[model samples]
Target chain A: MILDGKALSNQLDVNMKAEVAELKATGLSPKLVVIIVGHDPASQIYVHNKHRKAIKLGIESIIERREADFTEAELLQLIDQYNCDDSVHGILVQLPLPKHIDEGKIIRAIDVHKDVDGFSPESVGKLFNNSHEHYPVSCTPKGIMTMLSHYHIDPKGQHAVIVGDSNIVGRPMGALLLNAGATVTYTHILTENLSAHTKTADILIVATGVAHLIKAADIKPGATVIDVGMDRDENGKLVGDVDYDHAKDVAGAITPVPGGVGPMTITTLMQQTIELAKVADHRTLQPVR
Target chain B: MILDGKALSNQLDVNMKAEVAELKATGLSPKLVVIIVGHDPASQIYVHNKHRKAIKLGIESIIERREADFTEAELLQLIDQYNCDDSVHGILVQLPLPKHIDEGKIIRAIDVHKDVDGFSPESVGKLFNNSHEHYPVSCTPKGIMTMLSHYHIDPKGQHAVIVGDSNIVGRPMGALLLNAGATVTYTHILTENLSAHTKTADILIVATGVAHLIKAADIKPGATVIDVGMDRDENGKLVGDVDYDHAKDVAGAITPVPGGVGPMTITTLMQQTIELAKVADHRTLQPVR
Candidate 1:
């Protein structure tokens, strides 16, 4: 069975649209400010899609675009402006800034309350510790968890292998799985005998950008496979890390490349934006004696 | 081969003691403040041991004893006092606080600069993210990493299985190994066929606190095992999570219950206290024109 993320994302958007209308009725506008520095082509497409989704869901989306030569100080000043604005519920600075800009400093500059991208150290810490609090996580991993829940694929007592050690996806993804009671193994580029580990997984999550890294023989029969890769083949066709055409025959369930994780990530971002807005309003809307 | 954490700790202390003396000569007195709020016998012993170790290393140690009935507000006030003091380099609140006191609040109350115990969310985030910046970590796991490095048991390209899920030990231990380039697996009570996972580990770290939870048959021959449990056996004797009497024979190298991880924990605490003091002083000790 294929995990249809695009269909699920559309279904979720309908509910979110109603949620946004209700929130606005209560005088709370769910607003997100995305600050993108430089004109990286891929990042531009991502920003465009997010803005389109927010408008469709009735959420306020603001894209603050700057030139490639924008100073790090200027970017930080812009972030401070949105951070101090009570109406802005979420603030996200698109990553891979210019060489002159320090990414870590820029990430740390955003207020934790408005950290919708959930790339801040505080959010990462909360996720890893499995803190019993409402904290945002990297959208890709969080969206995968949502898809798993929708499909009733319980990770409890299962051996889940994460094939990548990226801070955004693989590390947080493993932590979420571990918190859900799955025995999670994290393998990276330095890992030895990758196939030996992947074959033992009851659930396999492949996030490495390497094209078709895991073949059909590397998969465990009946395992739930989640491919997070959006790599291009030699012929310039987009594909996942797993050889899905053959691995799908052996795997019990899987997510495809373009229509699977991509839509869900944007959907999760919008969901978190609305959630943060409600939380922010709740603090201010407290009844006084 | 035995991983003699006691010997390595004593060896490390010789160098730390000298380092402390040199800092003191430079008008910087490295000091640690440990606060114990209740009469938990185990916590008392742990606190006493830490104090003794600090004094022996030529570092100033202060013990703040409070009544079991002390209010959480009073405890917070005491932490604030230390947090404001420039003389204090590290603040530690012994765990298992009174039923009325909130542990998370207390942990966060300590200034991150003086968080010697490294329980703050920021430090944990840094550890998980493999941040390049210098940061303290939970003493136990940090101690294990020191032991691994001292013994030349490089974790790179190895499969390391952690058989517990406690925030202090198992979780951070896996993160440390993952940062060291090892493939890390985290297993807990909900893990099915736990032995099946342990058998594949090149480096197995067991900290479940369950007496004799892992036996010789459960281990892989020639695997390096580090047992972090401090459990009492059926006979009321000190033991570890692993059945060391028989399992030691199957393991290629292992750490014993009393002399292994135990000594190293105190050693790492003292090491970090001095390091934090130096870091704190470095920021204030700038040269003027």
Candidate 2:
């Protein structure tokens, strides 16, 4: 069974549109501060998608484009500015900001209430805590759970092995899997005998940006494979970390590239944005959807 | 090879003395804040040991005893007061506070820097994030690692299962084990076939708070068990989560009750206090020793 995230995203968009209408009727449009540093075409396309999605949902999207030379202090000051501003309901800092700026510090600076990206240390901490009410979860992991539900696959009694140890994907993914009652093992570069564990996962998620890194040999028959990587194969075509053709034959279900997890991330962002906007008042202490 | 935390705690105390002296020579003293609610005899003893140990290390330890009538706001104000005080290098809030107070809120209120107890959400978050610098680690898990190393037990490639899921013990223990390259599984009330998982662990740590909950029949041969629970048995005497008589004969190594993970908690508190004091001027964070 394919986990059609595009369909799930559409359903989420429907719910968000209704929520946004309710907010708009009250004369308060959801305003999200999207900060992008430097000019990468890929990032520009992502920002455009997010901006259009927000506008389509009746939420006001505030695009703040900073020059490549913007200092880390100045970026932090901007975060402080949004934290104090009553109108700003959510904040999203586009990743791969210039290498000089400390991404961790920048993410931590965004007030947890405004941290719709769920990159803030507090949000991470809140998610790590058993009670997930205080912070918004990272979008992609939340989307993964949403995607899993659509497939009617429960992680309970399952072993999930996540490839890669990224703060954005792998680490939060581990917590997300654990939250759903799955036994999770997070592996990185230093981990030994990687396949020995990967083949045992009832659910395997490959996020390492290595094209075709996982083959049929690395999977267990009837296992569920999730490809979160967007990389090009030797033939210069888009391929996932898993060798989709061979891996899928041995797998029970798989999420393919292009229309799979990719569409879910941005849609999750918009859904979280409207959720943040709906509960803007007393946002600090309140729960985000 | 046994992971003797009590011996390591003594060694750590010895090391803390020299570091405290170095800080004193620079006109700074490591100060740890200890806040306890009501008069639980056990908490009193724990606080006393911490204070005495701090004094031995040439650091200053301050105890704030509040009556059970204290409001949550009042407790938060106290935490805020210490959070702003640069003199207080470490803050330790003794757990088992009155049920009326919001423990999570109070723990979050303590500035992450001064959170020596490492019970704060940010500390836990920083821990889960690969190589986090600021959030102080939960002390017991940190201490357990030291004990493991002292006994030359490395968890690399080991299947380590943690029973119980307390924020203070089991949860953080799982994160630390994951960080150390162990295949980690955390189980609580919901986990099925508990013995099936427990019996496979090459290294097992039980913090279920149920006296003698883990039996020899449930542990793998030659496994290393670290008991972090202290409970009164039917005999009205304190016993650990592991049934020592049976486990000791079957397991390759173990840390005994009273001198095991129990004493290491306060010992780690003092060690972190000294380390925090030494780094007061320079904001460089210390690695978990």
Candidate 3:
């Protein structure tokens, strides 16, 4: 069975539309501010998509556009302005900023409550702590959890193998799966004999940008595979980390590249933005226990 | 061979003592302020041991003892005082506070830099992220890592199994071991068949407070076992989660209850305190990359 992120995302959007209407009825509108520095083609596409979706979902979309030479201090000043703006509930800064700016410093500057991207150390810390408050999680991992739930694949008691150690996806995903009661094993580039771990996974999530790092043989017989990779293959075509053609034949459920995790990532950003707005309105967001 | 925490901690103390002397010679002292509320016998014993060891290593030890009826607001005030005091290098609030005080709230109040116990969510997050900069790790797990190194037990390429999921030990231990290049699996109460995972471990760490939960049959032959359990048996004698008398016969090496992990926890606290002070002086603590 294919984990149809596009279809599931559409269903989620329907619910969000209702939520936004309810919030509006209560005189509260969800707001998001996305800051993108420079004209990186990929970053431009992402920023455009986010802004478009925000408007479609009835969220007030504000984009702070800057040139390649934006100073670190200048970017931080913009973040501070948004942080103090009660009207702004979600603040997202597109990644891969110019070399002149320290991305980590800029990320830390975003107020934790308004950090929609969930890249700050405080937000990351909260994710790992699985604290009592609801904080934003990385979109990719949050989306993957949605996919798992959509397919009715319970992580509890499963042997989960993650093929990356990145903070944005693999690391946080590992924490989430562990919290869900799966005995998770993390295998990174440094891992010796990666297949030894991969072969044992009941659920395999691969996020290393290395194209087709996992093939059919690396997957368990009927494992659930969530491919988080978005890379170009030898033919200049977008491909995921898994050999989907062969892997889908062997795996029980899989998510396709272009339509799989991509759509859901943006969808979660919008969902979490609405959730953040609700919390900002009532000052109460229950922890996801 | 016995993995002797007693002797290893003694060697660690010797080095820490010299480090403290060097800092003191420079007119700086590594100081720790331990705040204890109520007179729980166990809590008192832990506090007494920590302050005693702090003095032995020339670290300034200050104990703020409070009555059982101490309010949460008062504890928060005390934490605020330590957070601002330039002379205080580390602050520790003894656990199991009176029911009126929220332990989590008090822990979060401690300055992450001064969190000697490493119980704060920020500190725990840093530990899991395996961040470049040094932050205190929970003492018991840190001691276990020290023990592994003392015995030349490299976690790289090993299968490490943790048999509990408490925030302090099991969760962080899995992260530490994974960062060390091991394939780590965490088994908790929710684990379907506990022995199924335990039987495959090359390095097993058991921290469940349940006595003799893991016996000889549960261990893999020649596996290294580290028991973090501090429970009393029916005979009213201190025992560990592993059935030591039986497990020792099958295991290659193991830590004994009273003399093993206990002393090392305190020793690691003192070592981290001196390291924290060094950073305070030069402001140049390198990341653990």
User: What lDDT score belongs to each candidate, Candidate 1 first?
Assistant: 0.92, 0.81, 0.88
Worst 10 residues of 1 chain B by lDDT: B280-289
Per-model TM-score, in order, reads: 0.97, 0.91, 0.95
Alpha-carbon DockQ of candidate 1: 0.80
Q: RMSD in angstroms, candidate 1?
A: 3.4
Tens digits of lDDT, candidate 2, B1-289: 5567778788877887887787688788889889998888988998888888888888888999999888899999998999899999998778888999988888878887787887776777778775556456788887887787778889877878888766777778878887777777777766767887798788898988889999999999999999988899998998999999888988988989988887788777787776676566674555653
Stretches of model 1 off by over 4 angstroms after superposition: A283-289, B283-289
Best by DockQ: 1
Backbone clash pairs for candidate 3 read B132-B287
Q: Residues A1-289, candidate 3, lDDT per residue (tens digit)?
A: 8999999998999889888988899899999999999999999999999999888888899999999988998999999999999999999999989999987778878888888877776677676666766778888888899889888999998988899988889888988888788887788877778887898889999999999999999999999999999999999999999999999998989999889998999999998898789888884554653
- Which candidate ranks first by TM-score, i.e. highest? 1
Q: Pick the candidate with the highest lDDT.
A: 1
Worst 10 residues of 3 chain A by lDDT: A280-289
**lDDT tens digits by residue: candidate 2, A1-289:** 7777777788888888887787778776778889999998889989989998888777789999999999999999998999899898899999889988999888888887788988776777777776656567788877887788778889886878888877788888878777778777677666667787688778998999989888999999999899998998778899889998888789898888867898789878876776676567533333432
List candidate 3 stretches off by more than 4 Å.
A283-289, B283-289
Candidate 2 runs further than 4 Å off: A217-222, A282-289, B84-86, B156-159, B217-222, B249-252, B283-285
Q: How big is the positional error of residue B73 in model 3, measured in Å on the Cα after superposition? A: 1.4
